[model samples]
Target chain A: MKKISILALACMLAACAHYSLAPEGAHTVQGMSFVSTTDWNKSSLRSGAKSEVWTKDGERLNQLTFIGGIKDGQTIFTSRSKELPMPEFRANMLPNELMELVVTSLKNSSGGELVIDATNLRPQRLQGSIGFRFDMSYYDSNGLARRADCIMVKKDDRLNLIIFSAAGMHYYPKEAAEVDSIFSSLQL
Target chain B: MRLLLSLLLLFASLASVAEGAQRFEPTLPPGYAPDKSTDEGGLWYQVERFEEQLQTSPHIIRNTALTEYLEELVCQLAGDYCGSIRVYLVKNPHFNASMYPNGMMHVHTGLLLRVANADELGAVLGHELAHYLRSHSIDQWRNAKKSLGIAAFIDIGLAALHEDLHGLARDVATVGLMRYNREQESEADAYGVQIIATHGYDPAASVSLWKYIEAERGADKSKDTSSIFFATHPKVENRIARLKQHIKRYGKNPKTDETDLDEFQNLVVAEYEGLMDEQIALQEYEQTAEMIDRHAAIGYPDSLIKFYRAELHRQRKKFGDERAAIDLYRKAATFERTAARSHRELGYLYIKHGLNDAAKDAFESYLEITPNADDREMINFYLETLR
Candidate 1:
């Protein structure tokens, strides 16, 4: 009976640590609504409004992130106890500046752990609002090349962003279509 | 007041040295290696593991010219012992250099950026080499092991077994790995000047270098100059006087010693820009401004420097900053190799001040210059709004 109770507590703790996001229906995330066409495991994020992870081969090799309703003067990265101050996210920041913010955040938080390269930006329409989309190629700490597709939009004095990323090899190619479908299903 | 205090401390250090301390001799001769069965060999093996890991670290700078220059400078200071020591340049933005037990020295880019010329670089390298020659890490490790053994024994006896205590153990080990006493630091400082004198580099540059560090610390009290070595050493104020004493003892005529300013700038300026970008990203505007002021006064003008200057003003947005940014951006754009985003930033500033015609021109120029920029759609949107 004691062993059973311990097992149940461990299961509960695991569930609390890794939450699942419903994939078959629309979800409102921090005032931004979107529909996920594929199952993704929601997890606590250090930054951004909401975060989810997708694993392959028993490892968390892919991630889907949503940053919604970021207010003016707020930063896109989390504050650390003894870390240097971070740059704030201004509502009027240009797309290039926004890109720099993401790159800088990755570099600063990683302590030069990650190297990122973003390619040309394309026009994207999110819930009928004008937005910009870009693709990035980066190397993680272990020198694993990863690819990501991101969209950024400023709406009603708030910034909403979404990024879907996976390992640059087989995993990214396998999930690329599903990621595009998920982005296509975004709604206001 | 600080200068006076430093002088008094210098006198104190010289007076103390008159206690007739034995001069240190290098224990490890040229091409020395420990036997595999000994404890020193065990330490070397562990350090080899760390060196392997460091080789794969993303922060390791891999520029061939830069690495070669650093190794050459280190070798110049080390002389006969040069063959056994390996130098690794790291990309951390703090002013520090460290030597491991296995003759591996890691020099941070921050230290590289802070030094004005080759002699200053030699001073820092010579100090680190002094630590290596003396094998201070072995002493630190032995002392740490003794304390850790006692702590572990007590903890085990008390049956205070908890998962949290594992982290405590790691913290204790890390702290023990460093924390050399004041005696080791003074020895290293004194011997470091001897190495500089032997190499025909300016020994007084050590004093000047510490003063530069002192001035930087005074400018921004928040900046951490502490490294593995500085964390436990006596205050910089005391060290400055000791370094001055050594300079008086061993310094060559300034005209006879080599600064190698031209070669240092050539090898370091390109990397300096990248390091400065890292600083700008840190949002420590005051530190970056001080760097800009120092470099600009030295006449180190380049497109990247101008762009960052404009970026500094633009980010602050104080009174007249917008106008200053505009002018600085224009100057930066005049350089044929300026960053493409400078025009885009110019467009934003022009639009904010209701200069639609100028905004359009700037946006067009930005698009033309960076036809494949990642933010084309947004720039186009701005262009449409301006039209």
Candidate 2:
């Protein structure tokens, strides 16, 4: 009975943490929403390096654009592919304005209550800025657990946005610093 | 002897003070100080500070060419009454136009699309003018912060007015005389009808202008701004109705001159339309979300009503959502549609999920329709590889 209960608990947890198995970078929405942090950082969004980036078993629906936003070139992904949710890219909108949207999105949202401590991992303004790394644990419907650190970089205006996210439990701890350095070093 | 001379002096001063206030131009130049008895200088200062901060903010688009063009147009329409007040043509998709304590007005491009013509635009501008001239926001700012240190209060108040106003809208409605300043808006409305009529544009155009805005609200992608605008300025229906009532009572001779809609449309014709397309297309997720909101706000049409349930389920990724969106795509593709690209999307998803056969079918269906498809090469290659 105990064993059955444990199994049942695991199942329920899995159900609550249900993530789309579509594949990383497989589904490609045309435009990508990037630069996810405001100067305000009300949600502990930009915190120290030790901060959690993403919870284990948590699915982040994200897109990687090579150059311009969703309208521009190719996207980079891991083994799985998922379409990014394309967003408005006004011709009159400057980079700074879009960046503001990225940061203040939660502040503006009515139910935006999530706050994570991700200091150095915050998105910087400079091009070829370092890739970010952090461990995050999100609450699932059934109370399951997961962690991950997603590495993101702005490559160039033409074909530049490249992102690499992985299970934060192992990969974020081992290779995040190296990934950041690699992103920082990237000229193109 | 002293009391008699003092009494005579007080009356003379009162007479002159009233005369000077009348002479005071509601539209003051950048640095003009209002004579102490008249007190318009304070508003000018507050406006200056707001303008300075607005320049650096993301909303401010410093396009000299566009500003010059707009300035020329406004001058042509209301050259005499046109104050030193300038406008910033912002690039947001939400429809709103506002003026600050000084003479700076920010007009979102979204507002330009909704207005029918130059005359309608003038009404909005005239309303903004009334706010500045009457010193509504400034007086509101002053009355709300009367308890605090005047300098510190103004500093925080100006930032709060220009920067944190939206944030405060949820919390502070009654501050700085910002609370229920409808009297000022009425004054602006009255001023505008006369100005528009004086300028040889039809004074009655204001009624048509608002009716069109209300109609377009139903068509707007995000009705958030409209809902919020009406909520704060409640019973705008009454406002428009009242204006019509005014026109009836004092109905001036109808002008034969036509308001220039052609020149107005020409300013943003092809480019604005393209931006609108991107606004709708890029916000596809929001567009899908909008359907549910539509049902709640009003009743849904039969065709789209069904998708409301299915789309929510799909977003949650239950009951084979990929299949559902594909089904939706198939149904949608049959009609005269804007999202023809959806067919290609269905194909790509099928292949990515290791369903090559399903993908092949999707690609074939897409190829049948898209003659000059941008993704033709990729689709053809995927199909060839499957073979």
Candidate 3:
């Protein structure tokens, strides 16, 4: 647990809406830009409505979509040592679906009650891909349940995101819809 | 008027308890309290605060109908068998069961959701009861008085149970109540065996019960099993080994009908699949590691390993890993079709990757499926953003 000064907390909140142009800075990937809503994919798969997906080179490769995102400097990211090291397993797969499958399975598996309140979404970042967030229900049966709210940035056609799934009973209270608003409306 | 005013004042004081030296806070908002008012832990003021908070929630354990069934089993067993005692169903999923100084026992929902059978469940309940007869929570509190373990009792995690006490460093409360002391646990297990036998519940079920827990531990890759069980108890292998060796003492025990246990089964059946998967979602690296180890050790179903692998991918922040987790979540959701949360995560995945329409649809889909969701504000917020 790191000591977050009031200043640091303020910085994070302030940065929530602030996005730099492509090639942002050190913590950001090079040549990254926010995809326009027009290039996004509108899928009817989402509860009979369209979902927008922004991807690299105008393709679904490493796309950034939303519900909401969950963010935490310390907790969201898992150990990547194994994933990077296990290149042999990923040898034949396309990089995009490969990553999407991993994140998707991670969120989908934890079991809990499927709750979709109009406001149950949470936002989180995808990994080193770029800057993206993901959403899922709090702990559901694979766990309790958290609604998913995810965000990400597309850079060099890659995706980076912060993801969250908490015991809806415990985790959701700390960050949920507030995070969703922070994510979807984020200009960066 | 005099008595009424006094009561009103007392209620007001209890309701407004601040974080205190005596009062313990369960992580998150909701908390719990033991039925017996008198706590042997020398922290009666904390207990007083706990009593105050317990008023609103009453008992935090869910699936009330099932909990009542479990309580009845314990009470009935307590009446007939020598060591059977009262059980308080708890809502938490952390693996713990306790016996207070008084005869009352508090069992976390984690135990209820995990235990396989009524007999095994009885075994855990019986073990806690043994602590009451043995009087463990008080004795340990007295022995370690003024220790940092007690001092670090900040309100975090579970409101009733301190998550701080969960780590090896925080051995504040001895493994819930009975599971705390080895000698006590052993004594309880032995007595529980005898009690189960008398009640016509298979005594062998006790050994198998713990084996299931250990097996679950083995299957989890991220958990540090040593701390979950070993760190708290010194001679870890021996304790489990002893239970194995001791249960055999009553040779060739006849099996009890699991049929009569159906109502009991029906009671907890709802939470079983949900609990297992729910815990999967609460997957801490240590917890996953621990579950993997326990399951492998006891030879239970190794299916959870796939989840561990998926979680491993989740922890890794690369696009590849996130994609992998999403797919696994999909499979898990499919296998667990009723899992609205799983579907919601899919919805969330769509949202995070610049897929607003997808996010909206996923969120909307999620609401349609779940009976109740606490994230109404969050879901609504997303909907508004999309609009």
Best by TM-score: 1
Candidate 2's residue-wise lDDT over B1-387, tens digit each? 999999988985674344323322354343434554543465566556656655665434566544566676555544544565677876544456776655567676656655556667777776666666656675666665666767766665555545332333322333343443555565566666655655666667778767665555444455434244565563567678766754553365454544354566455442443334323322334433443353334332323433333333333343476667667655644543323444565665566467789878877877777756644654666688777
Off by over 4 Å in 3: A1-185, B1-59, B80-86, B146-171, B174-180, B220-228, B234-237, B248-257, B284-387
TM-score of every candidate: 0.84, 0.49, 0.50
| DockQ of each model vs. true complex | 0.32, 0.04, 0.09
Cα lDDT of model 1 by residue, B59-95, tens digit: 5777578899898889878888888899988756667
> For model 3 chain B, where is the 10-residue window of minimal lDDT?
B19-28
lDDT of 2 at A76: 23
Best by lDDT: 1
- Model 2 bad stretches (over 4 Å): A1-51, A54-188, B1-43, B56-58, B64-69, B81-83, B145-152, B158-180, B213-228, B249-259, B277-387
Question: Chain B of candidate 3 versus the native chain B: what TM-score?
Answer: 0.60
